[model samples]
Target chain A: MAPRNKYSVILPTYNERKNLPIIVWLLNDSFTKNGFEYEIIIVDDASPDNTAEIARQLQTAFPNRIILKQRSGKLGLGTAYVHGLQFATGNFVIIMDADFSHHPKFIPDMIRVQSTKDYDIVTGTRYSGKHGGVYGWDLKRKLVSKGANIFADTVLRPGVSDLTGSFRLYKKDVLEKVITKVQSKGYVFQMELMVLAKAMGYSVAEVPISFVDRVYGESKLGSSEIAEYATGVLSLWMRV
Target chain B: MTRAQQTVSIGLLFASTQLYLALFLQLIPLPSIISEEIIPVLPLWALVSFGSYLLAKLGYGVLTFNDVPEAHAELMKEIDLAREDLRTKGVEVD
Candidate 1:
């Protein structure tokens, strides 16, 4: 049997100063209720809003579980995780958002599904089940998201419903291999990871999850991100 | 895309229009109401195309270049300058 070790949560945050405490509390409650030993590694990209300072305060509160790895600047979303993964001690890693878009309650389910399937990775899918849906985004925002996923599906054919979704659980070794192969670091970074995983013959499964919009601060996604997505999509399309 | 990008694209379209006009202006010699009355905007289309091509190159350069190192170096220089100023004022920084 494979080793069942501590779970490390690598959360990449930027200007999520408001949601830090609540997200930490929610993770603590979820992990405590599930009786799992875990670590929350806050990977901040030197947010101007003092997100790293808040992470330090959270470290003082949780001591052992919460850790801070402040980056020099906003390099990219994908690189932030790569930076955090270097210091992650657990055999399994959970990567998610700090903006409350990814609820902590779904984590236990993701772990359970992975265990049943003996999967190397388990990602949350918003379009898989009846209950899973995005809340608090306008119709135009929803269309752009759906179109991106659809465009990816039509091209990459990664066999995953939600390639653009960031919330995922990965075996440390599997993540290590996948990250090494993923080159795109823009909006389609998540999509590239899954596509690369499939190319490498990794076992991946998805658990249904309901995604909620951010509760505080502004969303990082803008028109520029959409254009980046287009570039990333075409780049992958040509590669595959 | 910014205002410059839009202007370049419009200019490119105008360039193709001018090439068309330069070709059509010599043939048929249509009535004044059909061809001669229109604003003579097509001749500048070649310039528009050149401008658009340059703009496209600029856009590509912006996308492909990474400014992190330059930015980091700039920040370091500013920090050094500030440290010098502080030292002159007898301000200690740890």
Candidate 2:
């Protein structure tokens, strides 16, 4: 077998017990088949559910590949990435959803793009190119998602078409630098990281990926998240 | 801007208005010294207003976006715990 690339996947999951197992299986299939030495780092923010226990079991199942980094309390999403980064031991880092929205299937394409172009970052775009798509969201949901991205782009001019995508792969050092510079704590944190990345003139590549909605459970996103997203985008634009 | 600077902006606006009033009243030869001193307050007022705008943005950020002090405090606590754990294992946390 060819030497596998050490790809540390940092997954931030909050109350996602139901989705955890499936995500793990998918990630395992993707990396194992592709001959990649990967580690799954699940940062659980003291979720009220059994997410931590499930993560422990997955670690037991995968042993060397799945690493459970449990936190004491429910911290925000942005801080979770910072927490997970302390333990990420990979040449490249992958950030994505455990809710099944960011499919593991697109990850190979992302890796291929990065390898071919030698880009600093390869991000999944839902609305940018010809091939990207979104599933399971209603028309209104789509509009809200689209509008939020447009709003951030207009204010900060991040230059990336999809400024709010969470599925991305970064050079480990680049991820560290960008995560340190980013200050957003909630949903808008996703958008702000890209904005900061753009401001710092990082070379980025976009790959079209169909973002599927979670098959199980309700979405963690809501109107309140949107308000926080708006507030965060505005603050980052001014602060940075 | 500092609190003092914000007040200075309003004070400047007030003084500018007061100088105009003084000049109008001086047509009948009333006290005019107060107007000269107050008129110069205009620059201070403008300066204060600009400072206030920056302050307002800072205040908004502190309220809505990032809490630097809180995050730092939490980070320090985490470090302390990690250090203690390392000490138990005869390993330095550095």
DockQ of each: 0.02, 0.02
Off by over 4 Å in 1: A1-3, A220-223, B1-94
| Local accuracy of candidate 2 as per-residue lDDT tens digits, A1-240 | 855567889988888876676677778877888877789889998889868887776666666887888888888788888888889888899999887677686788999999897898999987744446665666567656666765676677777877888999998999899988876666777777777777677889999876666656777668888888888888987875
lDDT of 2 by residue, B16-62 (tens): 77866666555435455655665447568889997686556444422
Query: What tens digits encode model 1's per-residue C-alpha lDDT throughout B1-94?
Result: 2479779999999997776666567454656665654435445765798668655644543333222233334334544554454344343322
Quote the chain B TM-score of every prediction. Answer: 0.32, 0.33
Question: How well does each candidate superpose onto the true structure, as a TM-score?
Answer: 0.69, 0.68
Give TM-scores of chain A for all candidates: 0.94, 0.92
What shift in Å separates residue A101 of candidate 2 from its native position after superposition?
A: 0.3
- Residue A36, candidate 1: C-alpha displacement in angstroms: 1.0
The TM-score leader among the candidates is 1
Worst 10 residues of 1 chain A by lDDT: A130-139
